[model samples]
Target chain A: MLGLSKKDTTFLLVVIFLTLATPILLQPFPESSALAQFNAGYPDLMQRFAIFGIFAIGFNILFGLTGYLSFGHAAFLGVGSYSVVWMYKLLNYNVVPGLVLAIIMSGLFALFIGYISLRRSGIYFSILTLAFAQMSFNLAYSVLTPLTNGETGLQVYNNDPQVLMSEGSPTSPHFFGIVMNEATKVDVGGWQFTFSNGYYFCAIIAIIVFYLSLRIFRSPFGIMLRAIKTNQTRMNYTGLNPRPYTLAAFVISGMYAGLAGGLLAAMDPLAGAERMQWTASGEVVLMTILGGAGTLMGPVLGAGFIKYFENIFSKINDNILHSWFSALPDGLEDFVVFVFHPFIGKGWNLTLGLLFMLVVIFLPGGLIEGGTRIWNAITGKNRKKKREDAAHHPKPTSHVN
Target chain B: MGILEVSNVNKRFGGLQALGNVNLDIAKGTVHAIIGPNGAGKSTLLNCLIGKLIPDTGTVMFNGISVLGRKPYEINQLGISRVFQTPEIFGNLTVFENMLIPCFAKRDGSFRMHALESIAAERDIIEKAEHMLAEVNMSDKRHMTASSLSRGDKRRLEMAMCLVQEPKLLLLDEPTAGMARADTNNTIDLLNQIHDSREITMVIIEHDMHVVFSLAKRITVLAQGTPLVEDTPDNIKGHPKVKEAYLGEAAA
Candidate 1:
């Protein structure tokens, strides 16, 4: 079963199926219709979904298993993007070198940060990581302007020497002859499907990273990380130093973030200091938590959910809201649109925050736990009994700890 | 020479001396108990011995190796294990997983990368953990989360976790500190069985006289951060100075 346990193989297969079918699944609305704005099958948004999914999945490996909440993961992501851009400038427009350099550079950066941050646990650890990230962001924005291009960001320019690329080749990132931004469009009876090479590239990497994360979640190393989360004192007395284990998990996650950052650059060919901001880091945290931090599929779902809202729901305006309520009386429709105005369109973050609060207050385990509970209730099974049964007979590939 | 030797140990906390001129020689293959009234530095001494605290001036030698400046995990690698006052099992992990941790430590040394190796495939370690669980009579509850176990069972699991490492020296800080009489007796029996069947040495800090007399071959009574008396359980039971410092009354 692909060198993984049966359950893991199944999970991977399901993810593959869903990822390949994303274009059809996301573009449910017919083109040129009023609801066409809801179509997430567009190349740019689809690429974002897969990229952020990688970011959130990596984050889960750290915060979920080790219980070390890092507020600076986006620093690694930024470093990764910056590294890939440098690779493009010095080497070539080939994504392979750029991505490889991104992962390596971010992994090294993470190693340095994790070494210092892991000396403290809990809130102090979070604060240390945040401070480091903030420091990196500030530096990249100002003092490191030559490297990061300051506020303008780092991007490929025509004057740069691309040693590996011959003259007259496309400047945009490509894998061999296939341009990343190139899309193949298919027209059905009423629906249109866009199959983007960039989206597929990001999707394949995301799935591979997800599978690696699945392996890590079931590995003995993962168990040790969970043990550290459970009781570090016990781990210490058991003759295991938790620092190395935590550091390893941190670096691995940072590399994943770097991969995501590389994919972002491969798609758009730009790197911004703003991507290293604390807000970006918090978004990944939110994605992991909103999905289910420790669950296998949770982070990806959360990433898609957040990205979907950010790209689609935020596009709604007062006119769109009024159109939905147009059937009502004029005055009532105005009032209804006004009441719902602050939660949609430019106020999508408000809705996200409220949803986050609800999940934290009621579903501490996040959306996956909520879904599991609903499933249990629908099946008429006792939740507690099911949990106990799961504890007793844990699935081979599903080691949440 | 004793397996563990502590000499001229001194520990201070600001204005107060927590331990002063403390010296102990614990022979191999014996259960030694250190008892004292509250604040007599019982735990402080245990901490110093287990590398949790660095004595101001002392030498702690275990199997002829100095343990004063080493980390706790390093000390544990030197074949010493400590059971805390409260059970310190990994509450989020299953009881069986809790037991396997020490086995991993023993086999893998302080640290090794065993990430890709599945626990199910590690037949030797799993067998050892399961057998240890069977010995502790916790095989049936091995699947339960460690936190869900009763206080007594947690202590048992903690002890099992330590024993599976086959540590040269076992340090217990009140092994049965908060347990019913029945559980206390059961713990005593378990300790007695372990002591009889293995060549391991144990150092226990306890306030309960019954547990001390039942398991300890030699006892040290501390008073005011110093040893008041050191003798066999029978001799210390009626000693006048021990009564004055610990019992606070003449023996009936």
Candidate 2:
């Protein structure tokens, strides 16, 4: 189905089902329960999950497949957001034109940046990309203030000339006449689920890009990228140029970042220089690595994992911690909160850092490898099978004199 | 007329003349061997022909196209493939995938953005890869990782990768540099089969006398970056200049 192998098709179907049903899946805790704070069914956080998921998926194409670590991918994401917002100021609140322009503009940016950055590979290449991204961030923050609105960020204003806006059209970001922020709440007993127009829109785009990434992963171009990563010497002798292949991958991944950035603005209708920061670039790298760099579903899983921690874990303040441990003795409760304080709320980075370290050390292949290990353990499939299989298919022995 | 023509090729490296005043004409459809001792500049001359290094003053032409300053891939596109001393197969990919890359290169030129199409859908390329694997006696190991293959198998796979392109001239750089007696003979037999079956020209640079005499139709004795003599294998075996090249002053 869809020109994919049976295994890939099944994997893709599973991803689609999970993405479409994320609203209910994320709201496992009841509203009245103390654990309700953990529920991520709200439209704002859900939109981030889809948006960042797309961002990491695109980043994986360049970093994972080609083994070219791009440290400035967030530059493309920022460019994507600015394109969409500029479209909103010049065109209308409708997001289609903004999204279209976001993709095209970011592609051009990626082409220029990729052409230059790809000249040097390894750590030097990474530093070059980092430099370019930082340059872009500075430009957006100060020099390009007229376009980016300086520190205030770019937003749709009543005074701006929205050339395509009609009298009765929705004011906020919307597709046609449907407002993006509009949501329908479904309550089952104490549990609440929000199905938002914005989340679903981002979810649909995420699914499409995920499918495209999957196709690229299985395509000949994907194999060529892997070949470049493995051995450039062999590739050249085989009559394949690594430059064009790597550049194409870089542009494609940049476009993915752009699409994701555009989706972020579609949900919020704002563009800021902070989106292009080095930290933002590092976040996608963390997402790809934490999920499993080379695996298809790994990046999305990593994005969700990090976003969940950022939203849910960071909300665990001192009062919340105290409330949870209130049943214990006063002295013990104080000690418990003190121990947990450094890893939650404003210190959530501390927690994320610890987890990232653990994952890197114990699960070097990322969360996907951990999952595979668990699955293999459950199925009783051990490493011994490799030896047995090799034994069974012995290589044809060399002919003797 | 020879298919590969090298004339007045001189390469120097800071007080060292690696290949000085080298010249040769390799005929089409013949297994020609260039035999020399260590530091005789055999590999340097091979590198010059393949565009890995440019000679100070010379023209290295393949079928009349000068390959002096062309990129390695560009030279490869002009129908010249090189197999390294150590097998240079893609270690991370499976053996079958390794075969498919060269086939794709042969059909698609240097670049093609066939990103949306599935690799399995390329039926013709798959067939060609399978046929080539079978020819190399590696059909059973097609699914195995290229790196996991035995040393002999890696060499065979590398040779198969080059042959899949069906290049006009095949350059083998020490095809049996370090091998057991049995594996070396097996490689010789394999090379003999390939030479007998295909209309392909081959140039072999070798340190092994056995490998040199067993397969070469015509032989060039290179001594100190210059061709001392070019003769048939039978004539080369007893040539006084060839003796002096291999044995130094003792043979003279």
Candidate 3:
């Protein structure tokens, strides 16, 4: 955390190695190892982890650093998604153009919103962003029909004149004269893994974005934003008007959101206005807060966690659970089904709500706290250094300490 | 030539006239203290100087440039830094990281936007920050998280943060408001050490008479949002008007 020293970086790399390698090692286990389902190994889910991880990380840059609680960040994400899809429809299917569109559009949107919302502080800022996002959502669904395609969403079908895929060719709008229609699947001895080239392509972008966020988190500007969150008045009195610094943070985060949204659209060449809906924005906020607001890897972990639950829970029904538990004792099977009842079927949201509540109430800092707790538990340095650190700095509860 | 000038400055906040036609001039390298009672517009004056508040009718000149309508970061870029009564710092950051901000501001101006390169890699800034920390006797606490510092140390760190910018003017409000006598003495000594050693122009707004008299080269007393008198510590302590307007029963 101290500008990430070489030694500190070494420690971080070790953690990353452990997390990434864990899923590969889980391949040998039974299809349902207690932890196998949560390992984030599947290609579709893994790709999502990277994209939404980028989304939540970008959100954290604004919400976590500047202490601005945004309920409409998803609008930027949805806009990015729409722009990328439109790019694929009109231009070549190369990801670069989509990425650029996402950043530019997201940045433009953030600048507009930040200019107005940053005028007020506390709850007013949150609601202003929410209002702007709602405005975007309403326009995308109706007013911006030509671009956003109303409620039907934007998708690539070889319609009219804008088909770059060359009449009956299987390659969906080739990238730079090279068509990447080849889908590769690798099975490490019966785990049944399928990976589209798009997933890894997005995976690398997510990693780069993740690393960039880490750098921003530790920079001088990051510190200034955090300070602004803690005490804008004091900062202003200290001869530092927080507006410009916060505005910088807001724009950077907006660009990140745009990038994530753009990547999502590029992967599938379909953009729905629903993606820009307020609910989608709320989902990213959920992911960020559930994972850990200010911590680096928390957003990634939270994104992975939420996506995994969405995939697994959305498909599982009472019959599927009953069929699996049919072999158990009559009483035990009924009890098991009953336990998963409120959270198993259309109750995925109930589960999410419970998880959010638990994380918020017990661990307000999110997964970051859990990680630090684990690290502290293992190192046994907590008790000794606790007093010392406490003695050293007053640590006013103004912001993200 | 006057390095920093404020002429005919007036500030009104709704119903209150916080500063009434006030004018101030701070020479290049002098310790200028602004002393007033609880509601004498001490903070209002500092706020106007830093562009946190726009004066109703006035002009602020810093380094021969107009500072009347500049942003706080822009004013800071003009080499005017400020420290608060309560320690204003980045709690999550280390003591060392807190000092790098002004270096970037001073060298790179208000908007550096340097996305790459670790802040620690800025060796020149680090060296200078280290020097400032040593000046405040806080070099040993470099690696400590700023959130973990004692009250006295937080003030020292805040002082060093302002100093590292090498500002022509440093504005401090209540630098020793809530400190114990020992800590206050420590703060006074630290301010003295910097005043004796550095080429900084400081304007301090303090409630504590001991801190004000100890460090101020010249002190300005404000009563009812107007400058009561400007004099040396000896002259201020004995002046009937200052004592009557400030130090009488209420100053006790």
Highest-scoring model, TM-score:
2
**Candidate 3 — which residues are off by over 4 angstroms?**
A1-41, A92-96, A167-169, A173-182, A231-244, A323-332, A379-384, A387-401, B1-28, B36-48, B52-66, B246-252
Look at candidate 2 and give me any clashing residue pairs: none
Query: What's the residue-level lDDT of A324 in candidate 1?
Result: 84
Who wins the lDDT comparison?
Answer: 2
User: Per-residue lDDT for B57-172 in model 1, tens only?
Assistant: 98999999999989999999999999899999998889988988889888988777776767667889989999999999999998888887888999999999999999999999
In model 1, pairs of residues that clash are: none
Question: Which residue pairs clash in candidate 3?
Answer: A230-A398, A392-B148, A392-B149, A392-B150, A393-B148, A393-B149, A394-B149
Model 1: iRMSD?
Answer: 3.1
Model 3, native contacts kept:
0.29
lDDT string for model 2 (A96-208, tens) is 99899899999999999999999989899999999999999999999999989878999988899998888888889999888999999998998888999999999999999
What CA root-mean-square deviation does each model show from the true structure? 3.0, 4.0, 4.0
DockQ preference between candidates 1 and 3, better one? 1
CAPRI level of candidate 1:
medium
What's candidate 1's DockQ score? 0.56
lDDT of 3 by residue, A161-212 (tens): 4545555444453345433334455656546454555555666677567767
Number of backbone clashes in candidate 2: 0
Better structure of 2 and 3 per TM-score? 2
Q: Candidate 1 on A132-182: residue-level lDDT in tens?
A: 999999999999999999999999887898888887777798887679999
The models' CA-based lDDT, in order, is 0.90, 0.92, 0.77
Model 1 scores a TM of 0.95
